[model samples]
Target: MEIHPLHPTFGAEITGVDIGRPIDDDTFARIRQAFEEHALLLFRDQDLDDEKQVAFSERFGPLEKTFSQNPAGGTLFARQSNLDIKTGETIPIEDARMVYQRANMLWHTDSSFKRVPSLCSLLSARIVPPEGGNTDFADMRAAYDALPDATRQRLEGLAAEHSIAHSRAQVDPNLLSDYQKSIEAPPVKQLMVRANPVTGRKALFIGAHCSHVVGWPEEEGKRFVRHLMETAITPDICYSHQWREGDIVVWDNRSVLHKATPYDSKKYKRLMQRTTVAGDQPTVMQ
Candidate 1:
């Protein structure tokens, strides 16, 4: 497999490999190394069913079982689409399902609210919209590197609280049903800076799921995190992927933040399946 840089600094488009089938140890090692170095990898023109996708994703680590807030909750897959999971019919724009999906429009890292966070997320496009529906990714390692010396030093030991409820509430206050709220993962603290276990590269860990810095005053922490988010999500370090059918992209949840762009869901059908790899350990203990 050959890897080509998709962005000047981080994301890459990997070619000459078929992820739909089992891969040997040597090839998988190179793929994992590429993932550690690049943070994001895209493979095109590959057909993958759910079984195949899960098989390939397991090569990374253990798959995360989605939580109660999503339609795909309790399953290994986090379904992204406008159609009903069972009926397969278009959902209304104002429906709770659509509101839940709107949360995806905000820039966030996958499963950061979990105690262990996530290692990476692999999303496969089974169907694509005719226009719009792009996915944008920002390189957090580059973002961290670009910070001024004083600011970098100040952030060295800081920890932030992350929660799924906090992020979903940003989109809609009433989005989560009572049952969902009852089962939601409580807020957990994560180090504001994370270092890759393999490559030893450091990255800032702020995103939508991050509510506030752990010990700071509430509003002050929010304001500070917003400022850091602004610094990290700038266009200079971002790459937008306009997906095609049979495309699969894997992004490091530990080192990058991604968001879904708008699309005309009323006029088209789009289905994307995502599987998240659980992080090996917590960045910080509660």
Candidate 2:
């Protein structure tokens, strides 16, 4: 298989291999190396079933269980679609369920609120809308490299708090019931800068889920978080992926941030399935 870089900063497209079957160790090693170097890998025009998708995802590591809020919760798949499975009809964009997904439009690294954030996420595009519905990825590693020396020095030893509660509040406050709020996704003290274990390259870890920096006033923490997010997602550091049926994109959650673009949900059908690989282990003080 040949892997071609999509851009200088991030993304690569892999061709000439079928992911449906098991790959040899050498090929798998190369693929893993490519992933470490590229952060995002797009494989086009592959007909992968649920079984095959799960099997392929296992190559990276154990798959994460779907979030309880998703329809496919408890399973490996997280379904992203506008159509209701039981009703077999399109959900109105204003519907409560649809509104819950609005949070996804904001840039985030998946599962960052959890004590153990995700290592990577594999997304398969089963259906593509004619207009919009693009996914954009930003290379946090590149973003970190561009920061001024003083800014980088300041963030080196800091830890930021990340929470799903804060993200849910932005999209639909009502969706987070009292029980959900009480579940205590306690603040995690993650370093502002993360170093990729495999590559040893550093990346900025701040995103929408990051509500504040530990040991700082709320407003100041928020401003710092916002500044890092803005710096990481500048147009020069981003690449937007336009969806196509049978396209699969695998992104490193630890080294990149991703967001969804607006689409005509009323006019066309769009469905995407995602499987996330669990992180190696937590890096926080108890």
Candidate 3:
């Protein structure tokens, strides 16, 4: 397989290997290495169904079972679509499901609220809208490298709090029920900076789910988190992907932030399936 860089610093497109089918050990090893070097990898014109996608995703690690907040619930897949799963009819715009989807437009890393967080996420586009629903990714490693010496030093030895409820509340105050908030996904702490085990590249771990720093005063910590997000998401470090059918994008949750762009859900159809690879260990012991 040949790997071609898609962005100046962080993304690449891999060709000459079909992920729909099983790959040999050597090929999979190279793919894993590419994923570590480049925070994002894109594969185009590939056919993959749920079974195939799950199989390929497990090759990296054990998958995270989706939480009850999503329609898919206890399943391995986190479904992103405008249609109702069972009937396949368009969901009304006022529905809570659509409102939940709006939170995704905010820049965040996947599964950061979980105790184990996530190693990576694989999203496959089964159906694409005619226009407008792109995914934007920011290179946190590059962003960390660009930070001033003092900011980098400040980030070290600090941990931040993360929660799914924290991010969803930004869209609507009652977006998540008490059970969903306290049971399915509760607040957890993660290191403010993370270093890749393979490459030893450190990246800032702040995102929407990151509510505040563990020990700082609430408002102060929130302001600091916002500042870090603004610093990391500048245009130069960002790459936007306009997806096509049969396209699968794999991104590292530890060193990257991604958000969904707006699409006209009322006029078109879109379905994307995501499988998350569970992180092997926590960033810091709670």
Pick the lDDT winner.
3
Candidate 3 or 1, higher TM-score:
3
Q: After superposition, how far is residue 97 of candidate 3 from its true place, in Å?
A: 0.8
**Cα-lDDT of candidate 2:** 0.86
| Residue lDDT tens for model 3, 1-286 | 9999999989999999999999999999999999999989999999999999999999999999987777687999999999899999999888988888899999999999998889999999999998999999999999999999999999989999999999999999898999989988889999989999999999888888998889999999999998888776789999999999999999999999999999999999999999999999988888
- Per-model TM-score versus the true fold: 0.97, 0.96, 0.99
**Model 1 per-residue lDDT tens digits across residues 30-145:** 99999999999999999899999999999999999997657787899998999899999999989887888899999999999898999999999998999999999999999999
Error of model 2, residue 146, in angstroms: 0.6
- The residue ranges of model 2 lying beyond 4 angstroms of the native Cα positions read none
Best by TM-score: 3
Q: Mind sharing the TM-score for model 1?
A: 0.97
What is the TM-score (0 to 1) of candidate 2?
A: 0.96
Pairs with steric clashes in candidate 2: none
lDDT (tens digit, per residue) of candidate 2 on 155-182: 8888898877778887877876666555
- After best superposition, candidate 2 residue 234: deviation in angstroms? 1.0
Cα-based RMSD of the predictions, in order? 1.1, 1.4, 0.7
TM-score computed on alpha carbons, candidate 3: 0.99
